[model samples]
Target chain A: MSSTREIDALIDMMAKLPGLGPRSARRAVLHLIRKRALLLTPLADLMQTVAVTARECLNCGNVGTSDICDICTSEKRANGELCVVEDVADLWAMERSGVFKGRYHVLGGTLSALDAIGPQELRIPRLIDRVSTENITEVILALNATIDGQTTAHYIADQLDGQVTLTSLAQGVPIGGELDYLDDGTITAAMRARKSL
Target chain B: MSSTREIDALIDMMAKLPGLGPRSARRAVLHLIRKRALLLTPLADLMQTVAVTARECLNCGNVGTSDICDICTSEKRANGELCVVEDVADLWAMERSGVFKGRYHVLGGTLSALDAIGPQELRIPRLIDRVSTENITEVILALNATIDGQTTAHYIADQLDGQVTLTSLAQGVPIGGELDYLDDGTITAAMRARKSL
Candidate 1:
């Protein structure tokens, strides 16, 4: 081993993270060791705190430090609109735009029949309950443009057919996107959704 | 914030690592949270332990969880052959090869004139002390092939002129390298050091 047992173990765990490999993990571990007081200790303390306190909100399935997330409990976010997403990451991307003033419903994953995943496998049941009881006016299906995502969105739209208004994000050439580099499906969608000048 | 304060802080700290950015940091933190019991808690505990115990070897500059590293304390490694490297990471790489069963001397960094760093800025003085006292017969300059590395090696060779035999790593094609991809400098060095086939 290039390092001690404890250090090696730490590097191994870091390597298992999403973007880091063995070499980068070793560099990161060395950096953390050099800046022990500044980075390593505080990161360790923060990880421990998050581990003990972080949980998924019961209402919207969003991750937070309590049973109900801040967005779910805040009155300003009770704008009668609930945006449905495939994961917390999608919900976070939506929140980063700062254009949405309503709460979110995290589905955790889409309904995948090949994987034996159904509505109950995800948080779809809880989403249905929230739409019926929360006095929601509209449900936005801001899912990815994947087959599974569209299938899940269609299923949710069917379930809430007469309960409230159903909508989805518009598909078009993204801002700063070039038509030459776009895929055929995207180009076709943009052509069909063309608007007046 | 998409998540709680603690989670966001953790993500921010993770982003400061060498290979991770904000998006990847968020993904890593979310992974850590999902596997809190199996990964997060243990990693946090290990970081804490390493932060408290890790230190630089007094004799050499190798990092370990002690005042003097295991290599410095091992009697069988006293083979009168000292390998000098530029950093603790280099020392670890040397050890990983499982060759060179002697000892090591880490210089912390090379002497850089532009940075106003001299022999005293590195561990050159300590290396000289070890050559006189450690009964070393050969000193291998395992420095890098960079300009500063060569300059430091030449300086060290001059410092220990007649005391011990001096040598350096060979410059040529790497083990799995191809001729088409080899640089002109490396090809010239390989030609100069051509072996009798």
Candidate 2:
């Protein structure tokens, strides 16, 4: 709706965000303009700063301001148990829960045969290198339950077999998940993985 | 999940946007960082430019990069008709349809007795000034179909009664709107304002 090119460009770029569309982008831009000093300027400055400093960690593939992410650099995070995730968002999810104490390795993507993606394309070689060099005692595959995720996990498990303790996240019902709403595969997985009381 | 304060602050600010939550903000920031050269830099630059240039038009409430918006300044648009809207967003919506060739006067908000919003609080005084001074022959009250919107329309109509041709948007079923899904008020309005075949 904006006649100005700069405003239109801003809206276009905002529409490219993961959740926002063109309508929402227009609303967001107008809101930012109304609160320019409070929101627009600060957001622009922050984006500029992030653009200048943000980089992928060479060791762990996690994103941070430095070359090596804090998780890879921190001594306390090296708890001998490494968690391998398919994406940076998944790594962030794991961190938000405060469940994992070990370092993380972000694969960036899964091993997809259809897409011609191999282990080398998704930081699997780096994961193997970390396992051997970082004194990691165990490796947890925290990949999603999708077909590609499971395939990548299996490949990683096979590659690191007998080298370290290899494990995959237990498949089961999600928190607050209803059996009536769950798919057959999830129900079956939850049944097979039933633990002893 | 970012260890650096800069990235975390960026995520926080992004979360403050209208449609984004913390998770979405993190995802958007990550996406921006991943596509820094293509999207992030341009968005930041555009936002900065908009922040410096964008302002409310002095003649109308529409947002533009100049003192007077393009519609308000265009001689072709000054066809003795003024479309009044409750917000700049509504003005932009009307402009997108390309139906109304006349200029707009954004009220910024509607008359709200519950919120103690009076004529002076909104752009009602400015609308009154424009109607008398700008040789406007017809004024369209294109307010929303809400109680406040109708109330504001009545107040403006009362103020400009007998001064010029006053009209409001026709109430009826929207384009491709199904009767089964239509609300009672909408059906009533459509029935009362039915057009003869």
Candidate 3:
């Protein structure tokens, strides 16, 4: 009975996860009980480890296990190209294709005037600084093809207008399509056919 | 140029995420740069905090910010019914419904003979022990309808036969459909009409 309280509490918390409900949480908990070592134990261990070591890359804003992410420390990718996105999910989507050979900048979201979001609230200044300090030659505005995304892109283009080459993914990204929804082939095609903004 | 190398390394790592590709990662990185403070800075902070604090409930296998998950420690939920599931995702799905006032047991996965998984490899023993020690009156098997899921259910049922009431969610879970994919209403319906094995 005492442990049952604990179990109920666990189920309640689990129900709050993005996709689960009380029923499925109940089923899932039972399943985990039946596969403790292979799934439960390892999952628990991984969760604990990730809880303690997960972090965002200090220099580039990517999630990782270190202060300065692995990308920010590598010596093989200094190609003067910087790609942009709106969320970590989008960043993960891009990484799955394995075609881009540059660094990343996660925007977290689009500029929403209704939400009162502005450039100062974003990483616009840091981008400008990185453009100069990182000696970035080409800045690809690979944001989603939404109105806000395009607006943000135009704003950035204006800021670094004369300092560096500015380009963006061409054609494949549909109108209002978030980068996370596009397939690898489409993303690759878009990158290859990037147009100067 | 040096930072480009770092960026490339980061993109490479991003590509390894579940849904991203190189092209998208590049684009995402660029976006993050333009929205550094509004999005990137806060995201990084959150990631760092979550990375350091997320762990799993040792007793019921749910992920949380403590050694003994919040659910496990809470005293208000011991309803004598134990619902089981296959994964943390499923557990979360159940919790989202706001119903089911009992505990949970996460099995991690179904028993797969092809994968050489056995009862010992799962939390089966622990589950049986909990049934007795916790005064569990009803043990609900909410496993997926997959072949392996059914097999695991049968195996667990055999172990706990006549020890307590054993039932399963009635019908709403589609054949081979993961609980993660089911909507909350369907999960609730299934739970409300759960049938004895």
- TM-score to native of every candidate shown: 0.93, 0.97, 0.49
Per-residue accuracy of model 2 over A55-126 as CA lDDT, tens digit each:
999998888889988888889988899999999989988998998899998999998889999887889888
Q: Give me candidate 1's TM-score against the actual structure.
A: 0.93
Candidate 2 backbone clash number? 0
Query: In candidate 1, how many Å is residue A40 off?
Result: 1.3
lDDT of 3 by residue, B1-197 (tens): 11234444544543443344666555544444445555444433443343345566788877666777656676776878899998776676677765777889888778888999988888888888889998799999999977899899999999999999999977777779899999897798678878899
Please rank every candidate by lDDT, starting with the best: 1, 2, 3
- Share of native interface contacts present in candidate 3: 0.00
- B26 Cα displacement, candidate 1 (Å): 0.8
Candidate 1: CAPRI quality band: medium
DockQ-based CAPRI category assigned to the predicted complex of candidate 2: high
Ranking by TM-score: 2, 1, 3
Pairwise TM-score winner, candidates 1 and 2: 2
By DockQ, who's the top model here? 2
Among these predicted structures, which one has the highest TM-score? Answer: 2
Q: Tell me which of candidates 1 and 3 scores higher on lDDT.
A: 1
The per-residue C-alpha lDDT of model 1 at residue A153 equals 94
Docking quality (DockQ) of candidate 2: 0.81
Angstrom error at residue A24, model 1: 1.3
- From the highest DockQ down, the ranking of the candidates is 2, 1, 3
Evaluate residue A157 in candidate 3 and report its C-alpha lDDT on the 0 to 100 scale.
92
